[model samples]
Structures are given as structure tokens and as C-alpha cells.
Target chain A: MKNIFTIIKKEFSRFFKDKRMVITVLLPGLLIFAVYSLMGTVFSGMESVDENYKPKAYIVAAPQNLEETFSSILEITEKPSLEEAKKAVTEGELDIVVVFPSDFSQTIGTATPPDVKIFYNSAERNSVYGYTFVTAVLGQINTSAFTVNAASDKFDLATGRDITGNLMSTIMPMLMFALLASGCIAVAPESIAGEKERGTMATMLITPIRRVELALGKIISLTCFALLSGISSFLGVILSLPKLMGGMVGAEAAAFYSVGDYFMVLAIIISVVLVIISAFSVVSAYAKSVKEAGSLISPLMILVIVLGMATMFFAGNVPHVAIYIVPLLGSGLAMSSIMSFSVNPLGFALSIISNLVITAAFVVLLAFMFKSEKIMFKK
Target chain B: MTEILKVENLKKSFNLSRKQQKLEKTYQKVKVAVNDLTFSAYKGEIFGLLGPNGAGKTTTLRMLATLIKPDGGNAFIDGKSIINEENEVRRKIGFLTSELKLEDFFTPNYLFGFFSELYGVDKTTAAQRRQVLFSKFGIDKFAEVKFGNLSTGMKQKVSLVISIVHDPELIIFDEPTNGLDVLTAKVVTDFLEELRAEGKTIILSTHIFSLVEKLCDRVGIIINGQLIALDTLENLTKEKNLEDTFFELYEKTTGDRI
Candidate 1:
């Protein structure tokens, strides 16, 4: 155990003692924050409310009651015929066209709900935005009219909290998983294969310490550093989240998570990092040089990306407990579960256990690789 | 004198690449690095394994160091088997080679302490040993300098100091002075002598006969993965000078005169 600590100390000093290494470890998180914040700013600008630029709408048989509400956000022109309005929309002169039945206002109190038709080119940006604005105004009118006239209690309006929750579950898991993976990839290769490439590993092998101890020391230290980088990048994303989400559908999604939620996130991140470090250590041990290590570990990056993307659909809907035991897949599911605030501790426990087991297996494999002269002393 | 190290028919073989076999125009797949090798070193003596390049000196030393497993036979260090009790064997020996390197990111002082801890040397003893070795090697002057920035001589000195941080009973050096300048080589040779005088057992491998002649109390000449000769300097030099005698042995073994 002391020998393992000694190795850890050496590995840590290898990175922390050098200013350039420290920068490399820290730079990714800061860059993520900066880039995400900038993206949010640009997207927010794109989605800014343009009070002066109203959508040009042509309406037929326009209802006097709802016309005032629609005209507030749209430049309305009464059309005599639906063909003229349809042509205007297709020709791109009109952003949207609304068609109403001749008895639309009178049939509102009837058993049948009147049909309202809206037409716009989906591909045109102006038409899309105009369609969105007109629907929002119409939705408000429908809600008000239904509340006053209808005797139903099943009216469902999604609250900001629900919208934010959906956004958090859908996106946060993928981002967190990707950030953790990138952080581990950044340093694990250099810690193990870099030493081998530099010939320092041979010197280490000649020491009195057990080979397994050396493996443990390296994996532990690498895990610590990788976790640090992963968390830093995660925080970078979290801190800039508001900016990135500005003008997004659920801009207030940041408020959906509590302090306890973040702790769960950290726990999941650390567990996942252990498995990453161990796997990377084996890859590093197999590589002859740092450059080769990088090349060999590139496929693992693609795997991480795939796992991260997998979390998108799995978020808030993780299946069986068995699924949480499949290494990266489980961790991704666990991460999605945590962000969604629907985490089953038992499932997370399974993920943590499975990852730890994988890490241990990989560590043992690394020790065996260290013991193999063919691998350790390969030219 | 008590023998602290022993080798009994130690053997190691490696699979050759298809390209190498084609280049050699041989269908042989396995290249025997060391074959049925047998020798021993005693306490308080410098025993040298002399060999040309690719003659399996490094492989033999590496096996003895327990860095690689032997395919056949076994060796013992201080009565501990290299095969079964590798960690015990490791504790009893200090192995160094030209192929080993210290991390350039670390300073000599830092590495000394680090290795000392790995060897389980207590803090006070490690510090005392560090002071003695550092002063002796002139490493004290640049103790804080990162190893990468140090001169080759300085790096070699630091490596030498660190390799024996535990004061192990037996020390193995593979071409210790292979790439050193004259002054550094002298320092290394002198240090080996000093260790010998302190009653430490030393085994080294080298292709240079002069180094064997000057430092080794007894020398073993390995050629083509086999020990062709082993004798004291006096006995080996009885009939001819060391160089002529080496060539005579080589010619007898390979039917090639050089």
C-alpha cells in the first residue's frame, strides 16, 4: 500500500510539477465554458423577441373576438378568398395564412369544435417563426375560451418546471458523460504509456514493489487527476449553462436541479472515471509510445461519444437494473437518471459496483501486462 | 565466500517477426535469447558477464532481476527463487541498465526520496543515505534540477544513486558505463569499487573486455546465447592477452576468425 502511494505521488508530481501539464489539464474546462457561453450568447441573439417585426398573416372569415389577440403579434389582412391567401403564403409574400369556417364563431358553443386551418412553408425560417408566434397567440385564446365555456377539468398546460425538467433529462446527461470521458482521455494515456515511452517505466519495473501495486498506484492517481479534469469541465458546462440555454425553450432549466442532485452527479462522475482510468491504463501499457497510445485510445473516444448519445433517449426512462451493470452504458444511464431527479440508488449502486469491478479487472490486466516482458520491453 | 546469487540452466526465447526471419533467410520462428545458461556470483566480489551485442547478456540480467520470466530452469537470489518469490528476490537485488531511465520531470532529490520510500526505507535512514550518496556523486549541487535538463553524466549518477537506495545485498548493472564520457565512466567504475570495498556483491554485463579486465574479479564470456568461457582474469590471461584469447574462443565457437 505504501508502495502504491509512492507510485501515486510520483505520477501526480509528473503532472502537477510541470506548468505546461497543469495548463493542459485545466485548459479544456475553461475552453468548454467559454465556447458554450459564446454559443448561448449567439443563440440568444437569434431567438430574441423582435417586437417590431410582426408576422404578415392573411386571414379568411376572421373572428372578431380572436382577431384582436392574433393582430397583436401578427400584421393581419382580411382575405376574401382562401386561394388568394394560400397563393400569398406559397409565394413567400405572406408568412402564414389562417382559414376559418363561416360559422366558426357561432359553432364555438356547439358540441363539435370548429376546425381552424393554418398554412406556412416549413422550410422558411420566417415562416417557421411566424407559425410559432401565431400558434402561441391562438393557444392563449383557446385556453381562455375553454375555461369560460367548457365544463372540463382536464386542461393540461405544461408549467416551466415541467419544461425545464424535460430539458435537463434530455440534454444534461449527454453533456456530463461526454465531459467526463474527454477529461479521462486527456491524461490517462500520458500517465502510463508516456512513462513507458520515456523509459522511466523500465526503471520503475526494476523496483522492489509488486507489479500490482504499481498498477494500482497509476490507476488511482490517474483517476484522481481525470476526475479533477472531468469535474472542472462539468462545472464549466454547468456554470455557462444559463448562457448556453439562453433563449432556449427551457431557459430556466438550471433551477430544476438542487444541491443534492449535484452531489449525486459527482458520485456518478467519480465512479465512471475509475473505469475510464483503468481501461486507459491497459491501453497505455500496450502502446509502445505516447503517440501510439493516443492513436490506440481514439476508438475509446468514439465509444464514449456513442455512450453519451445513448443517454439522450434513456434519460428519465432507464429500464431494468440489469442495464446499469454494462460498464459505460450503465454509467450513462445513471447520469441521465441523476439529472432527471428520478435516480434509483439501487441502480446507481449497480453502476458503481460494475464500474469498480471493471476497473479492478483492467487493473489486474495491466499488472499482468507489466509482468509480461513482451509487452513491457517491446521495441 | 557465500554465494548470494545462482543461475541453474536459465533459458529464455522469443518469437521472431516474419520480416526478421525473411531477412535472415531462415524459417525458424523462435529466436533463443538465452539457452541453458548457468553461473553464480559471490558476496563482496565484482562478477562480470562479458558479451557482444545480442549475445543475451541483457536477457540474462533481466531474468535474474525477475523483470521477465524464464521459459526453463530457475535462479535464486539470497536463497529466494526468482520464479516463486519474485518480490523477495527484488528486495534483495538492485538492478540498473542503460535501458532504464529516470523521469525527466523529477529532480534528483525527489526521485531519491521516492525510490527510498518504495524500497521501504524509513525517513531518517533515507535522508541520511540521500545526503551521503548525493554528496558523493556531486548530485547535491544540482539536487533540485529536473532530470531532463541535467547532463547525461548527471542523470547517470542520479540513476546509480537511486538504483541502490535500499542498500540491497546484490546489485546488477547492465552496461553501466556504456554511454558515459571518460570522467563519468571513471566515477561509475570508482563507485563500483567503493561498493565492492563495502562488501556488496556486484554483477555487470558489458561487451568491453577492458572494463571486465579492470573491474571484474572473475568474468564470464557469453557468445551467441551461450556461456563459452568463465574464469578469473589471471587464469583467462594465462595463455594469451584477454583480446586475443576472446577471438580464439569466438573462432572456436562459430568457426569464424576475427
Candidate 2:
């Protein structure tokens, strides 16, 4: 046990003591935050229009009742020629062209009303807005209609907590798995296979500890580093998610999840991380070098990514409890349940237990591989 | 003198991959690395296992170091079986080879402490021993330097000290002077003599004839995975030099010339 601690300390000293390794671990998270925040801001910028600016449109044969609607939200102007207005609208200079028949509002009571053509470029944000306002105003002509959901208040009955839960449930499970898998990939190969590649493993092998102790040491230490890395990345994704959602979600999303829920999520994440790191360690032991280990682990990472995406497709409560014992995919399913506020206690318990059992099996296999001379000494 | 190590019919062979077989231009599927080898060394003298590369000297050291296992037989280090009591055997011996390397990211000072702890050395004794060994190899000045940043000779000195971090009774060093400068080589040769004087058994494996003559009390000559000769340096080289003696035995065994 002391020897295991000794090896753990050595691995930590190797990772945290070096500036390059710290950067390699933390930089991805920092970069993710920076890039995602910038993307959210850029997307908002490209998709929004100024409230004070009204969209300008050309009226070919302007209906007189439409004048009131244009005064508030639309700038309807008379053009010299319809051809010129179409050109301006196509060229993105004009917002839209509402070509109406003369006295079109008077003929609206007829069973077959003449069509009022509202042409606008869907690509332009303001133009799309302008087109919607004009169509609504025309639709109101010659009818005493009750407005459907016309009040300025928010109409959806779902609370802020529901919105947050829905958003997180849709995205968080995939993000968590991918980020944690990345963390495992970043550290496991370097710690295990890099030692083999650089010939440092044999140095540790000559020590008096059983190879199992060394295996335990490496997995535990790497789990710590990978957890650190995963948390950093997870923070980046979580903190930026509100903005990425175009202000649909924010810090309030965290409030929806109770401390118990958070602890459960953390537990699941740890289980997932253990499974990932242990599996990677086994592959790394079989591989001859860090590069070869990476090659060997790529397929597993892909499998993890696919399992993560599975959480996205599994909406609402997972119907069957069997999915909670499928290792990586199971943890992901449990995490999604937590995010969405539908925690199945039995499934959650099963998932965590299943992951831990798999991790132990993987560690045993890794230790056995460590004892193989050909695996350890192969060229 | 009391015997510190014993070997009996130790054998190891490897399955050659198709690519490896093609490279060696041989159709044989298995290549024997260490074959039915046996030898012994006493508690307080230097014994040299002299062989050209691929004659299984390093493989034998690896087996005793518990880095790998022997296929057919077992060895005892101070009566601890290499196969059964591997951890105990590991505690009783120190192994040094090019195949075992210190982490480049670590300074010699850190690696010494790290490996010392792994060897279960007490902190006070480890610190005191570190002081002595570091100063002995002039590693005291470069103790804080990373292993990669150190010169090859300094790296070698640090590796040597790290191998003996627990002050084991038996030290096995393979090709200690194979790539050293004259100064570092002299330091290593001098350290071996010093350890022997302190009553530590040392097994030195090398191909250099002069190194065997200078430091070894007795020598085991190996060729083609078998022990071809065993004698004192004086007995083996009484009439002819060690190299001429090795070639004559090599010719007599497999009828081959280097």
C-alpha cells in the first residue's frame, strides 16, 4: 500500500511538476471556454437586429389599411417601378416588397381573395421579421378576429427550472462523456505507454512492489489527473452553454439540480472516468509506445463518443433498467436522468455499481498484462 | 565466501513474428534467448559474465531482477526464488541496464527520493545514503538538473545511484562502462571495487575483456545462449589474453568466428 502511494506520488510529481504537462491538461479546457464563448457571441451577433431600426419595404400597389401596420414596424415606401423594387430586395438593399392588388383589403371578404404577395429574403434577419409582420397585418383585414396568444407575456407554462432541465438533458450527457473521454485519453497513454516508450517502466518494475500494486497506483493517479482535466472541460461547456443556447439557459439551470442531484451526477462522472481510464490503461499496457497506445485507444474513444450521442436520442425517462448496466453507455443514461430531474434510484445504483465492477476487471487485466514479459519487453 | 545467488537450468525463448522472421531471414518460429543456463556468485566479490551481444547476459539479469520470468528454471537470490518470491528477490538485488531508464522529467534528486521510497528505504538512511552516493559520483552539483538535461555520463551516474537506492546486498550492472567517457568509466569501476570492499556481491555483465580483467575476481564466458567456460581471470588468461581465449572457445563450441 505504501509502495502504491509512492508510485502515485511519483506520477503526480511527473505530471503536476512539469509546466508543459499542466498546460497540456488545462489548455484544452481554457481553449474550449474561449472558443465556445466567442462562437455564442458571434452567433448572437449574426442572428439579431436592432430594435430601434424598422425594416424598409417597397409597396407597389399599397393597400390603405396596411398603412397603420407599416407606421409601427415597417417602412413602406412607394417605388417608381416594381422591377426596381424586386431588384433592391434581391440585392439585399430593401427588406421586402409587399405587392398588393388595388383595394386588396376591400376584397378580403370574398371566398377567393386575391393573393397579396410579400416577397423577402429569408437569409436576411430583418427581412424575415418584416415579412412576418406584413402577412399578419394583411390577414387581419375584414375580419373581427380573436388574436391567438397575442399578449406580450410569456405563453409557455413551463417554469425556468423545466427549461433548464430540458436544455441540460438534451446536451449535457454527451458533453460530459466526450470531455471525460478526452481527459482519459490525454493522461492515460502518457502515464502508462509513455513510460514504456521511454524505458521508464522497467525502472519501476525493478522495485519490490507486486505488479498489481503498480497497476493500482497508475490507475488511481491517472483517474485524479483525468478527473481534473474532465472537470475543467466540463466547466467550460457548462458555463458557456447558456450563451451557446442563445440565452435560452443560464446559471439558473444549476439551481434546478439539488445538491443531491449534483452529487449523483458527480458519482456517475467518476464511475465513467474510472471505466474510461482503466480501459485506456489496459490498452496502453498492450501497446509498445504512446503513439501506438493512441492508435489502439482510438476505436474505444469512438465507441465512447457514440454512447454519449446515444444519451441525446434517449428522451424522457429511460424505459428499461437494463440500459443502466451497459458500462459507458449506462453511466451516460444515468447522467441524463439526473440532468432532466427524473432520477431512477435503482437504475442509478445499478449503473454506478456496474461501472465499478467493470473497472476492477479492467485493472486486473492490466496487472496481468504487466506481468507478461513479451508485452513489457516487446520491440 | 557465502554464495549470494544461484541459478539452475534457466531458459527463455520468444515467438518470432512473421515480420521479425523475415528480418532475421530465418524460418524458425521461436528464438531461444536464454537457454538452460546456470551459475553462482559469492557474497563479497565481483563476478563477470562475459559475452558478446545477444549471448543472454542481459536476459539473465532481467530474470533475476524480476522484470521478466525464466521459461524452464528458477534462480535464488540469497535463497529467495526468482519465480516464487519475486518481490523478496527484488528487495535483495539492484539491477542497472540501458533498458531501464529514469524519467527524463525528474531531477536526479527527486528520482533518488522517489525510487528510494519505492525500495522501502527509510527516509533518514535514504537521505544520508543519497548524500554519500551523490557526492561520490559528483552528482551532488547536478542533483537538481533533469535527467534529460544531464550529459550521458551524468545520466549514467544517476542511474547507478538510483539502482542501489536501497543498498541491496547484490548489484547487477550490465555494460556499466560500455558508453562512458574515461572519467565516468573510472568512477563506475571504482564504485564497483568500493561496493565489493563493503562486502556487497556484484555481478558485472560486459563484452569488454579489459573490464573483466580490471575488476572481476572470477569470470563466466557465455556464447550462443550456453555457458562455455567458467574460471578465475588468472586461470582463463594465464597464457593468452581474454579475447583470444573467448574466440578459441567460440570456435570450439559452434565452429564460428566473429
lDDT of 2 at A305: 90
Across residues A27-54, which tens digit of lDDT does each residue of candidate 2 receive? Answer: 6677777777776566531345667778
Candidate 1, B1-258: lDDT as tens digits: 999989999999988898989876889999999999999899999998987788899999999988889999999999999999988988899988878888888899999999888888999999999999999999999999999999989988999999999999999999899789999999999999999999999998988888988999998999989999999988999989888888899899889867
Q: Alpha-carbon error at B14 in model 1, in Å?
A: 1.0
- Model 1 iRMSD vs. native: 1.1
Candidates in order have lDDT scores of 0.81, 0.84
Top DockQ hit: 1
Instruction: Go through the candidates in order and give each one's DockQ.
Output: 0.74, 0.70
True contacts kept of 1: 0.92
lDDT of 1 by residue, A1-379 (tens): 8899899888888878877766776776898889888976665213333557888888777788877777787888766676777666655577777667778787775667666667774424466577777667667766433222133321112233443454456666567667766777778778888888888888888777888999999988888888878877877876776676553434455667888877887877888888877887899899998899889888987787787778776545666789888887787788777765677898888988998888889989999999988998887
Question: On a 0 to 100 scale, what is the lDDT of residue A107 in model 1?
Answer: 77
